[model samples]
Target: MPVPELVRPAPPPTRPGLALPRPAAFACTGVLLGLFLVGSTTPSPMYALYQQRWHFSAIVLTEVFAVYAVAILAALLLFGSLSDHVGRRPVLLAAVVVEIVAMAALGFAPNVGWLFAGRVLQGLATGVATSAISGALLDFQPPGSNRGPLVNGVASGVGMAVGSVLAGALVQYAPGPTLTSYLVLIAAFALSLLGVLAMPEPVPHRRPLRDALRPQRPTVPAGRGRTFALLATTMLASWTVGGMFMSLGPSVAKGLVADAPYVVGGLTVAALAGVGGITQLVLSSWSGRRAVRVAAPLMIAGLAGVAASVLVGSAAVFFAAAVVLGVGWGLMFMGGFRMLTGLATPEHRAGTSAMIYVVAYLSASVPSVALGTVSTVFGLTAATLAFAITAAAFSLVAALATLGHR
Candidate 1:
């Protein structure tokens, strides 16, 4: 129940160009969001190290990971649409503050319980920040500028990638995997928080807090279901691979490559996410319309690559598989994102985005958790193979469904 940040009561200055308000605090918007994202999963590579430190089982690793995703989804479900009602800046600042607490808790957390508690706080913070920050990027652009949203998207992608690299390297080489990375993240979060405090308030937002307290449901348009269906279908498959690697791929990597450092495991996951970001940009620029049109086939091949990685059972091959799937994931998401943006009007933009994101992140979360749970009952390898097959099969079915559409 924190009051939003103090804003200049005066209306934002008209900068004429795409520039919105170059509020003193606007410069820090991207920085703050990037830091929040980093804190959310910076510890991915270090989870295996924690397992060794605490002598926990694979089930425990996934459970710990699940806590973070669950917290994030809950926050997004409740607060994802908050920025539309309230201004973006206040929500972002709140998120930064929460990040400070989460990072600190991780730094000094005595046990697994502390990890989940910290992750939940961090998740809540992210839910507040993401929707708000992205909107703020648009809000802050000088009147005629269009580079803001694009830059903002790339910033988010880079933040996610770099955070893992930084955390992974530290976990591999540092004396305190849990403490050092969080300490560094803590400093970054604090700086970003201060910067956000200085941003000019766009307009006074008066929405009741009750707006964000309830869970909303997702629905598809009648005619538009084809687009949404295709988008969601491939998204579910691609995100399953994402969740798989994000949550347990590290452990699998370590088992396969005995010489692999915990950080290397992190790099593998980062590489996948990073490659995904890069692929989206590259494909968008180079592939042109024809490429974008054939989303179904490209995605199927990508899922098949995930299956191949399991069948090969090689770390090197796994990396390659990740790259291929990442490409497919990137393309599918890009097309889907564009379609989602297309389907919704200005009034529905924020809510529609949230709906689509809910679909995307849930597939990434619940399916991965299910896969992990089943992995516990069976062996990791067997469970991975099963998940791989299922994803591949889904891709085939979706490809057929979308075949006539393209």
Candidate 2:
């Protein structure tokens, strides 16, 4: 009797001339991740411009940022595993197309409403593309290799750093602050869309749509509850710091640095992400648990430094703090992800991973708007210090959780 299709795995089929070589395909997946984040963060430096042009308050500014986070979360919840049913390449291509449209919306944005629309579209595109790209990387990994998680973290960090730095420079010196950056991104996405079309599908076997499209709830797999809880806390802590930098770091920098250049604001984010990417690369071979162990203290120290920088009103100190936080961010994510990957069954890995991200992005979203509103009432420095303290508390909790779990 023949075995059922679901019971036996099929051999991977060859696609001569249609598929990229394995190494090249793997590298392209990383590139796609970088580009998606590049689009996601390209709007950061421009927020100041938007505020100046539209006369919106800080509360409104954060709301704009929060909308993207909310949209991304919505997409993840709704279609987290959609690629599993439909295939990775199609979802990736569709996402890039949506990103292109979002870029165009930003380029031509005439009002605050248009900016919100563009942000929402960008969020949806990024949420879709991130899952597919990360999954593709794992599919293409060499046997016994642990490069997938590292690549995922590094690509995102590199993208955030590069996108913010480039956008800031362009906004300062280039003729079109808002329009030019999006134009460049649009061109990049157009090229990426072509690349996605050319790449072969990595996930060969597909499950039924009904099964794959089922609403995903973030849950810790059996026997993984303790580790998952700790890691979730680590993610929440690190992502809160990241969210603060991405959403409000620029404004905070502006308040501190006298006669600051536009690039100064972007520099805060760039420092965190660039240093983070480098740190992850340098420490890629370390065990995930070791990485987390190193990350906890660094997180506390970095938060302390940020608070000090705010009190002293020193850009150098702020930048230094950003660098330290970047290291923590890199290690924290890598460690938690590695641990999560080990604990989850193959069948449940994707959903488990998505749950972690959902938690992290939520951390990035809600507190930032609250900080903005508080800053409006109190002051940027006071608000930053308060936020840093809260983030530190979470980091300490994560540290305790990790220590107890091990």
Candidate 3:
């Protein structure tokens, strides 16, 4: 017999533990995400107050918030996939510089136009940062059995909540609300910059910035489209409600809560956001059968609860409903994101995520801003009802589309 060929044995599969992130790197990554997210919503709570100070109409508020969404969409369309080619660090660094400029502009803004310009640039920075930031933070977590997304998601949510709450409180009780708010943020932004620098660059893609600027819309197998659509719709429902809360919930609470501290207003938004962020932790990893099945029902119920709170006109009841709505929002968002990520190829992940964001941010901007303008004319009651109705309808569509997933 011929001597047996000596084939080299394949190397042992590297376990996740071997890939475990250094403790310092992991912690810093989480902090970076937190800082970025906190800055994202710092302006949300202050918008209503700005109205009080500057005497702008709700329409203007909508214009301001809408501008941010517009910028975000434009950036995502232009640069969402750039990290895939250039390396996450460079894109994130560029994002940091832009964010700093935004904060500075907001700090000293002399006119509504300046406010609008500041918000638009801020949105652009966030758009680029989030896609790479979330993934970068996840990289630090051990692959299996590590609550990677949840940790990152919760950090993102908490950061958002703190920014709003803190900014609102500082702006309300302290002198120079705008100036002080940005001063704190300037420090936070600087820290985010430092964190990004310390992180090792993810592998480079060897492509040009021009290549990344082009669209890479995802088209999964025909069989998987419904699966993909289900998640998309679910997010649509949840984020629609999110849009309502972010843009107008503070103003609504301001009317009913009577002499509400700016702190309360900020916390009100934070309360909903915090719950949604936490609920994501449970929903993302549940062993319960058919997590997706429950997502839509929860969203519908949450929408109903929000509608009820609006009709009842009780601030306490309103916040309670917000908590329930948050839970629903978390379930739907996490469920949808998981499905979206799973269904896409690595090449298309960033673009697809941006597409989902496009639907979400548009829903957030148009309705919320419309209500902002409407509240100026028809008053808060009509605007509140309008928002709830839109959210309800959106959820119904999502639920039905996702039913096929079962």
Candidate 4:
């Protein structure tokens, strides 16, 4: 009997800890990315309401928006690579917690100061999450697939569109408009937190946390200078258009349709962002070079239509122009994102993504503040026209630059 005994085989090793399957994790990460942007733009529809309630000047309103962008920039530069050192789940969890606090601040705000506080907190949370979530997206994407950038572009445009319209509806029809929207966001974010907790760690090899905490300068990947420069130019032009809309599009809508409902203002933003999201989906298979070539002319024409709509006081024209511009915006963003991701390796993915966002938020923030100043001094119409013209000019330059390059 002893001689008949045989050696037992060991069981196969299993991955430690509870985590979602990779496919589910991939989808959840995309939703989380959308949710973060949703939180970021939810306040857009509330700006006019805040100004009406608190009696703040246009400059002050813009300051509120500017503060958020600046906080985002700071967080992006400082904590962008932290997820690469730690894991995606931890960074996302912490950011969501901070976002919940930010939402609470806005939900209960009694004064303009509270608005600033809430926006700053929201910005920090968003900035920190952006690179981490984006990197996680890349990590979870199927092997040999390039769907990550497409997901990023589509999620951002759709999130912004949803946020603007959702907040507008709540503000116009729901009880306690300001408080109610934040309450909904708080609940949504809570659910997202649970999702993050269950998500698997995507970063396989991590560096020490202390080293990754240092501030990082934005850097183009090696030998990617010309491409990076062209992409940066595209970012500057495209995001400037986005910044203007998020900050003042609702107000501009108010001017165009004086008797329109709050939802009309929201729809104005939705037109641009929703259409853009659809365009991204449809054009996902296009090459970056071809996309940009098409984008340049459409952007110029759309901007021109926008200016004319403002002059003629035509809401129809404005909406039409927004649709055209949305297409261009989507193409520009998707193309730039595709090119940028191609330039990055897995190890430096988060850092590389952060660098592009550094360029983006800068364009979004600085020009928005300047446009606000112009609005305060000259009026919203003049400022919008000038902004459109400037954006179109930049788009022209970006297209030419791309064409000249190989």
TM-score of each: 0.85, 0.92, 0.86, 0.90
Model 4: per-residue Cα lDDT over 3-32, one tens digit each: 000011121122357678777888998898
lDDT per prediction?
Answer: 0.65, 0.78, 0.69, 0.80
> How many residue-pair clashes does candidate 4 contain?
0
Ten-residue stretch with the least lDDT total in model 2: 1-10
Error of 1 at 204 (Å): 3.8
What's the lDDT of the predicted structure labeled candidate 4?
A: 0.80
Residue-level lDDT tens digits of model 1 in 81-170: 676566666677778888889889878988878877887787777767775776676666666764455545455555667777788888
Candidate order by TM-score, decreasing, is: 2, 4, 3, 1
Write the residue-wise lDDT of candidate 2 on 273-327 in tens digits: 8788888899998877788888888988998999999888788888888889889
Q: Give the poorly placed runs of model 3, Cα more than 4 Å off.
A: 1-21, 143-146, 204-206, 217-231, 287-292, 345-351
Q: Give the number of the best model, judged by TM-score.
A: 2
On the 0 to 100 scale, the lDDT of residue 99 in model 2 is: 91
Residue 369 miss distance in model 4 (angstroms): 0.7
| lDDT over C-alpha atoms for residue 69 of model 3 | 75
Clashing pairs in 3: none
Ranking by lDDT: 4, 2, 3, 1
**Best candidate, lDDT-wise?**
4
